[model samples]
Target chain A: MFGAEFVPLSLPPLVIGSLAAVACALPGNFLVLRRQALIGDAISHVVLPGIVLAFLVTGSLGTWPMMIGAAAAALVAVALIEAIRRIGGIEPGAAMGVVFTTLFAAGVLLLERSDTSSVHLDVEHALMGSLESLIWLDGTGWGSLFDPEALAYLPPELPRLAITLTIVALLTAIFWRPLKISTFDPGFAQVIGLPTTLIGLGLVSTAAMAAVAAFDAVGSIIVIAMFICPPAAARLMTNRLEIQILWSVLFAVLSATTGYILAGYGPLWLGADNTVSAAGMIATVAGLILGLAALFGPCRNRAGAPLGA
Target chain B: MLLDAFTLGLGYNATLVTLGSALLGGAAGVCGTFLFLRKRALVSDAISHATLPGVALAFLVMVALGGDGRNLIGLMAGSALSAVLGLWLVQKLTRHTRLAEDAAIGAILSVFFGFGIVLLTVIQTMEAGKQAGLESFLLGATAGMLKSEALTIAIGGAMSLLAVLLLRRPMTMVAFDPEYASATGMNVSRIDMLTMMLVMAVTVVGLKIVGLILIVALLIIPPVAARFWSDNSDTVALLSGAIGAVAGYTGAALSASAPSMPTGALIVLSAALLFTFSLILSPRRGLVAAALRQLKYRDQVHMRQGLLAIALQQPIYERLTLNMLGKQGLLRADGVPTDLGRARAAKALLDEERWRALRTLPQFEAAAARYDGLTDLEQILTPDQLTEIDAHLNRPHGVPA
Candidate 1:
C-alpha cells in the first residue's frame, strides 16, 4: 500500500543517490575515454584506509577530513601504481591489484583493531552502506522547507552530496575544454601547451573527492559502478562529448531513482516482506542500462568508439 | 613458542586448515603463472567477484531441495558456472562491443557483486538463513573452517595441481605465444579454456579460504614474485608454487597463533612481503642486482673509453680512469696506451664506428640483431677512414662532406 511513512523514508535516499550518481558519471566519461576505467575501482578501494585513518586522527567522521584523506590516499595509490609499473616492470592491472588490496586489508585490520562502535564505521558498512535507514522526516510536506527548525532538520547527507555534485558540475563545465582535449589527444594537447598532465591529475582528484563524498551514502561499490557504467553506456549512445555528458547524467539519475524505488518497494510488490540494499540495486540497474546500451545502441558495432577513441 | 606453533602446538583443525591452505596456495600459484603470462590477471578478479551470486543461488537451491545449503560441491559447481559465464560475457563484450577488457571486467565485477548483495539480503530475511554464514565469502573465515571442508580443499588442491602438471606444456605454449601454438596446429582456444577451467577450480575451492576480494592476490603475487628470480617458465612456475606454499604455511601458522588476525589478509600480506623481497633482492632481474650490474657495466665502459681516448691521442679525461686502467694492466702509468690497450682501443673504436653507422641508416633500424653481422669491421675501415665516413654520414643528404 502507498503509506505515509514510505514517502518520507524513500525521498532523501533517492535524491542523494541520484546526486552521487551524476557526480561520479561526469568524471567517469574521461576515465573510460582515457582507458583508465579501473582506476576508479582502485581509488575507491584504496580510500578505505584513508577514511579509517582520518576517523582515527579526527575522532569524528567529518566530511572535509575524510575527503582530504581519501583524496590523498587515491593520489598515493596512483603514484604507487605508476612507480611499480616503471620500476618493477609489472603490468598496470597487477600493480593496481597489489597496492589497493594491501591498502584495503590494512584498512580492515585497523578498523577491527580500533573501537569503531562509537564512529559507526565498520568494514561491512564501508562495503555496503546503510541507505535504508537514511529516513528524513523532521518535518512533513513542502511547508517544512520554509521553517528554520525544519530546514536545520534536513538529512545531513543531502546537503553534502548536493554541494559535492555542484562542485563536480562547475569544475567539469569550467575545464571541459582541456579535459576533452587531453583525454582524446594528450600529445596534441601537450603540443599546444594545455598542461595535459595537470588536467589529468585534477580530473582524477575530482573523481576521488566525488567517490569519498558518495562513500558514506551509497558505499564504494556503487560509486565504482556509477563511475564506469553510466559513462560507458552514454559513450555507446553518443559520440559528441557534450551529448555524452548529458546522456551520462541522464542515465545515472534514472538508475539511482529507479533502483532506489525498486529496492524499497519492488520486493513488496512481489509478495516479499523485506527491502534489499538500495546501493547494490543502483549498481545493478546501472549495469543493466549499460548492457542494454551495449546491445542496441547506435555505437554498438563501432569498434573504435569505446576504448580506442 | 613460534617453533611449537609451527611444529604442532595448534589443534587438529588448525593444522589441517594450515596444510589445506598451503596446498591451495601452491595450486593457485602454478595455475596463476599461465594467467599472468597471458596478461589476464584482472580477468581472474572479475571471475572471483562474479561467483558471489552463484554462491547465493546455490545455497538457495540447496535449501529448497531439502539439503543443508552448505553442500560444498553444489556451491562450487554453481560458482564455477557463473564464473565461466562472467568470463564469456567479458569476451563477448570485448570482442563484439567496443568496451575494453578493463571496462568489461569492471562492469561484470560491480554488477555481479551487486546482485550477490541483493541475494544476500534476501537470504538474511529467510528463516534459517542467518546460519548460512555466507558473509564469510567476502573476507573469508579460516577459523571457522571444518575438517570436512579442509579435506575437500586438500583434494581439490591436489587435483588442480595434477591438472597444471599434466597440461604444463600446452598451457605454457599457449600463454607465451598463442599464434605460434595455433600455427603449429594446436588447439589454442581449447588450451586457453582448459587453463581457465583450472583457474576456476582453484578459485572456487579457494573462496572459503581467501574469499573473493583477496583471492586474486593469491593468483597474482606469487608468479610475479617468481619472475624476479628466473627467466625459465618452468623454474618460475616452480618457484611461484614454493613461495605460495611457504606464504600459506606461515600465514596460517601466524593466524593460528594469534587468533585475532584475519587469515586471508595475513596470507596476502605474507605474499606481498615475499614479493617486495624478490623485487629488491633477487639475484637476477631485481632492483639491487640491476643497479649493481649497471655500475659494473659503467666501470668497464669507462676503462674502455679511456683506453680508446689514449690510443686516439686525446687528452686523458680522468686520473681515476688512468689509475684503474693501469691497475687492470691495460694502460701505462705515463698515460700512453700499452700495446694490449692499443689493440683493445682499436677494436672498441671500430665497434663504435660500426654502431654509429648502423644507427644512422634507417634500413637497419628495425633489426637489432644486425649488429652481429658486422664481423669484418676492422678490415672495413681504419681510424682515419672511419672519421671520413662519419663526416660523410653526418653531412646533409645532398651535400658533400
Candidate 2:
C-alpha cells in the first residue's frame, strides 16, 4: 500500500518495537508466572516520577541519565511496595496500588513544577516517544558499516535496539533456570537458598528498562500493552515456559509490525495528518489480541468464573 | 468555621463537593465491606479502569446526539452502560474461556482503557474546544461540582445505604461463610451480582470526587482499616462507613486549600494513615494490644516461677503456714497474704515441663496442700485476674478442663 519511501519509514518503528517486545517478554514471562501480571501497570505509572526528576536535572531527553534514574526510582518503588506488604500487612495488589499511584502523583506534580519545556518531556514524551521522528534520523559519518547492506545506512537507534535486545537475551540465558524456579514457586525457591529477592528486583528493574526502551517506540502507557498483552496471550496458548516465551515473542513481533504498517497508512487513508500514534495503535492491537485470548483460551475454572452460567 | 463552610454564598459550591464526596465515600465503604468478605476486593479495581471507555463513548454519543457536550447525565448514563458491558464481557470470557478471574480482569482493563484512549484521541481532535471540561473525569475536578451533582450523589448514597440495610443479614451470612450459605440454598450468584452492582454504583458515585483512576482506594482501605477496631462484622462495616466519610470530607477541604493537590490521593492517604493508626493502637486487634497481652502473660509466668522456686525449697516433713510462707521471698512478710501476695506466693509449678501447662490446677493445689497440710488457699483464688492467668498458663492443654 505504501511506496518505497514508506517502507523505510516503517522499518525503525518495527525494529525498535521488536526490541522492546523481546525485552518486555523475557521478564514478563517470569512476571506472569509469579502472578504479577499487572506489575507492568504499576511500573508504567510509577516510573513517571523518576523520569520527571531526571529531566528536571538534565533539562533534556538524554536516554541514559533518564533511564538510569527511572530504573533506580522503580527499584525504590518495588522495595517500598514490598516493605509495605511485609511491615504494614497490606495485600500485594493494594500495596502496589498505593505505591505506584503515589509515585505517579508525585511525578505529575514535579513535572508541573519543573521549568522545563512546554512539551512535557516527562510523561507525555515517555508515553508517546518520538517514534515518527526517531525512525527517520540521518545516520551520518563512519556509521556506514552499521548500514543495512543493500538498502541504506542504518539509523544509530538500530544498533542501540540491538544492544538492548542482546542484553535481554544474555540475561535470560544466564538466569533462565533460577528465574523460572523463582517465578513458579518463590517459597520453595527461597527454601532452596535461591536469592529470590535479588532475582525479583532484577526482573522489576529490567521491566522498567524495557519500559524505557518501549517508550522510544510505543510510549509509556502502551508499554504496558507490550509488557502484559503478549505474555498474557501466550499464557492462554501454552503452559510450558519455553513455549510461552516463544509465543510471546512471536506475538509481540507480529503486533509491532502490524501496528507500524497500520499507523503509517491509517491516517493517510483517512485524510488525516498521520496523527494516529504508532505506539498507541500497536498497544491497542496488542490489547485486542490479549482480550481475544482471554475469551477463548482452553482452560478455566467455574468457581470464580467471570460470568454466571 | 462550620457556619462559614455551610454559608449559602459563593462558597456553597465547595460545600457541595465536600458533602457529596463524603456521602459517596460512605457508600463505597458499605459496598466494600461485602467485597472484602467475598475476597473480591479487586472487583472495584477492574470496574474502575474498565469504565473509561464507557465514559469516553458516552461523551461521543452525547456529541453525536446534538446534546450539550458538558452534560452530566450523558456522562453518568455512559458510565453505567459501559460498566454493565465490561461486567458482561468479563463474565463471558471467564465462562467460555480458560482465563482466570484475575486474567479476565487484566484483559478487560487493558482493552477498555486502550479503546478509551483511542476514542479520547479521536474526540480530542474532533471537539478540541468542548473537550476541555471533560478531562476532569480522568483526573477528577471537584471545582466543577455543582448542587445538582451533589443531590444525585446524596440520593445514590442513600439508596446504597438502604440496600445494605435490607441485605445486611444475608450479606453478613454470605461474607462470613459463603460455602455455608451456598449449601443452605441461598442464591449465591444473585447475592454476588447484587453486591457487585452496589459496588459498581458506589464507584460511579465516586467519579466526581476521586475520578476514574483512583476510586478503587475508596472501596478497599476504609473497611480494612475498620477491621482492626471492631471484632463484630456489623460494627466494622459501620465504622468503615464513618471513617470513609471523615476521610472524604477532610480530603476535599484540604484539596480546596491546596491547589494542584489531587483529591483522590489525599483521600486515600488520609484513609491509609488512619489504618496505620488503627493497626497500632486499636483496642482488640491492634499491635499495641497484642503486645501488652504478651507482656502481661510474661509477668505472670515470671511471678509464678518465683513463688514455685520458694515453695520447692520447703521441707516435705514440715507444714508451712501462710505466715511461714510470707517469710520466704515468694510473699510479703505480713501475717495475712493480700490478694497480690497470695497471687505471687501460691505459684505451684506444673508437672509437665511445658510452660504453658502451668495453670492454677490441683497440681498447684496438691503442692500447696502438701505445704499447708490441708489449707483451702487454692479455692480462695477464684478471682477474674487469676482465671485469665490460669488460661494463659494452660494455653497448651487445649482449653483446660
Candidate 3:
C-alpha cells in the first residue's frame, strides 16, 4: 500500500508531526501535573507574532530565524503574563488571556499591515500549518530511506523536530527530581530551598521551547493538543511519573500516525475525493484517547487507591 | 476618510456592520466582567474556539439541504450546538477526571478547533458558490457583509444586552461569592451557564464581523480594563460594556476607512490600547495611582524622621529629608531649625515617646495598632489619654504637667 508517491508525499509529514507531538507531550506531563497545561496554548499564540517579526527583519522564512523569533516572543509573553498578573492584581488565567489575546491580535494586525503578501505567512497558515505538504521531495522508494543522497533532501522540519525532541527529553531527565518535587508540593519544594520560582520559570521555559519548535513543524493546533491531551490522558493511567511519561509518548505517536493517515486516506476510504487537515485529525484523535482514559482508565478517579508502598 | 467612517459615513453596509459590532462588543464586555470576576474568563476562550466546527458544519448542512448555506441563523445554530458540546466536555472532564478546569479547557478548544479546521478544508474543496464566507468566520469579516447579516448581528447584540441587564444582579452575586449565591438559593451553576451562554451568543453573532480569534479579546479586554477603574462589580460591568462598544465602533470605523485593515484585529488592538492606557493611568488601580501612593508614603516617612532629627539637635544628612524640610519653610538658610520647626520637632519627639509607652500598655491596644511612625499621635489618642500619658513622661512640658 505504501508506494513511491507515499514515501515522498506522506511519510515525511507523518514523521515530523509525530516528532513534534512527542516533543510537546514530554514536558506536557509536568505541565499537566502542575496544572499549567495552557502554557502551551499561550506560547503557541505568541509564536505567530514572533515568526512574523522575524520575517519582517530577516525578510526570509529560514528555519533558524523563525525559531529565534518565536523563542524571543515566547519569553516576552511569559514576562508580560507575570507582569500583568502582579501589576493588575488579576488571576493568572485572566492575565494570561489578556496577554496572549493581545499578542495574537498584534500578530494579526502586523501581518495585515506588512508587505509580506508574497510569502506563505497568513493567519490561517499560522494556525493550521500545511502539515500535509512537508514532503520528502528527493525520495524515490522504500530503499531511498537509507540512501544518503535521498535523505539529504528530507524536509527541514524533520531534523529540527528531532533535535527539539532530544532537548526536551534531556531537560526532563536532567531536572527530573526537582521538577517532580516542585510539581507535587511546591511548598515543600520551597522549604527544601529548591528555588521554586526559578524552577517554575524553568518548567515554563522548557514548555515554551517545546511549544515553539512543535508549532514550527505542525502548526499550533497540534502544539496545543499534544501539550495537554496526551499527558493528561496518561495521567489517568497511573500515578507514577515515570510510567505516565512513557504512556504519553506512546499516545502522542499513536495520535500523530493515525491522525495523519486518517487525514490523508480516510476521506478516500469513505469515497471522498480529497484529504482533510492532519493537525485537526490528530487533535481529534488525542481527544478521543483522553475521553476513553477519562472514562475507564485505572486511576481515573480523583482519589485513586494509594500506592501500595 | 477615517473620520467619515467613524461618523458612519462609509455608506449603508459599513454603517450597519459598525453598529452591529458595537452592540456585540458592548454585550461581550458586560458578560466578560462577570466571567473574569468568577475566574472563568478563559472558559469563554474555549467556547469561542469550539464554535469553529459548528460554523463549518452549519455551512455544509445548509448546502446539503439545498440552501445557499450563508444564512446567519443557520450558521449560528450550528456554532451554538458545537460550542455547547465543547463546553459540556470541559465541565464533564473537570468534574470526572483529575484534569483541572484549565487542562480540560485546553483540550476541548484545540480538538474542536482542529476538527473544525478539518471541516473547513472539506468545505474549501466543495464546488459551492457561497462557501467563501466560511473563512471569514476564522478572524471575522466586517467588510462587504450583507445588510441582513449585519442587521441580525445588531439585533442579536441588543437582545444579549437586554439579557445581561436582566441577569446582572444574580450574575454579580454569583461571580463574587458563589457560596453566598448558593446559600441565598440561587443556582450558581445555572447562573454560570447563563453567563457562558451570553458570551457564546455574542461570539456567534459577532463571528461574522469580528472572527473567532478576537471576539474573546472583546469579552476579556474591556472587562479587564474596566476593572482598573472601579472595584464595584456593577460599575465595572457598566464601564466594561461602554469600553467594549467604543472599541468596536472605532475599530470598525478605522478598518472601513482603509482597504487592507482586517476588522477583528483592529478592534482587538483598539481594546488593547484601551487596556494599556487603563493599566498605566487609571486613578484608582492603575500604575500611576500605585506609584503616587508610594511616593506620598515615602514623603510622610521622611517628614517624620526629619522632624525627629531636628528635635534631637542632630545634623540631618539625608538629602531628601533636608530638601523636604526646607521646602516646608522649617529650616533656616544655614539649616538650623526655625521656631515653627522646633515646635513641630518637640511634638514629633513626644509622639515617638508616647508610641514606645503605648506598645507596653494593654488598655490602648486598638489605638496603638494604627501606630505607623507616620500616624499623628493625636489621631489615635484622646486629649484626655494624651494628658495622662504626658503626665507619665515626667517632663510635663505641653500642659505644664
Question: DockQ for each of the predicted structures, in order?
Answer: 0.60, 0.26, 0.82
What is the descending TM-score order?
Answer: 3, 1, 2
Model 3 CA RMSD to the hidden true structure, in angstroms? 2.2
Candidate 3 global TM-score: 0.96
- In model 2, which runs have C-alpha deviations exceeding 4 angstroms? A1-9, A53-65, A106-135, A139-164, A182-202, A212-217, A271-274, A294-309, B1-10, B127-132, B145-154, B161-165, B283-401
Q: What is the lDDT of residue A28 in candidate 1?
A: 92
- The TM-score values for the models, in the order shown, are 0.86, 0.78, 0.96
> Proportion of native contacts found in each model?
0.56, 0.17, 0.84
Candidate 1 TM-score over all chains jointly:
0.86
- Put down candidate 2 lDDT per residue, B82-201, tens digits, no spaces: 887778777776676555566566566666666666666666777542444655676566765667776776677677767776777788788888899999999988888888888888
Residue A80, candidate 3: Cα error in Å is: 1.6
- In the range B1-401, model 1's lDDT, one tens digit per residue, is 56755875787788877887788889888988999889888788888999999999999999999889987788888888889988888888888777788988888888888888888899999986988999888877777777888788778877888888899999999999999999999999899889888888888988887888888888888988888888899999999988888877777777777656777777788888998899899887788998999888777767767866866778786877877878877787777777888787777765666667757766546533445432444554467755545664543565567
Better of 1 and 3 by TM-score: 3
Candidate whose DockQ is highest: 3
The lowest-lDDT stretch of 10 consecutive residues in candidate 2 chain A is A299-308
List each model's interface RMSD: 1.4, 3.7, 0.9
| Rank order (by DockQ, best first) | 3, 1, 2
- Interface RMSD of candidate 2, in Å, is 3.7
Estimate candidate 2's alpha-carbon lDDT, on a 0 to 1 scale: 0.68
Model 2's C-alpha root-mean-square deviation from the true structure amounts to 8.3
Which of candidates 1 and 2 reaches a greater TM-score? 1
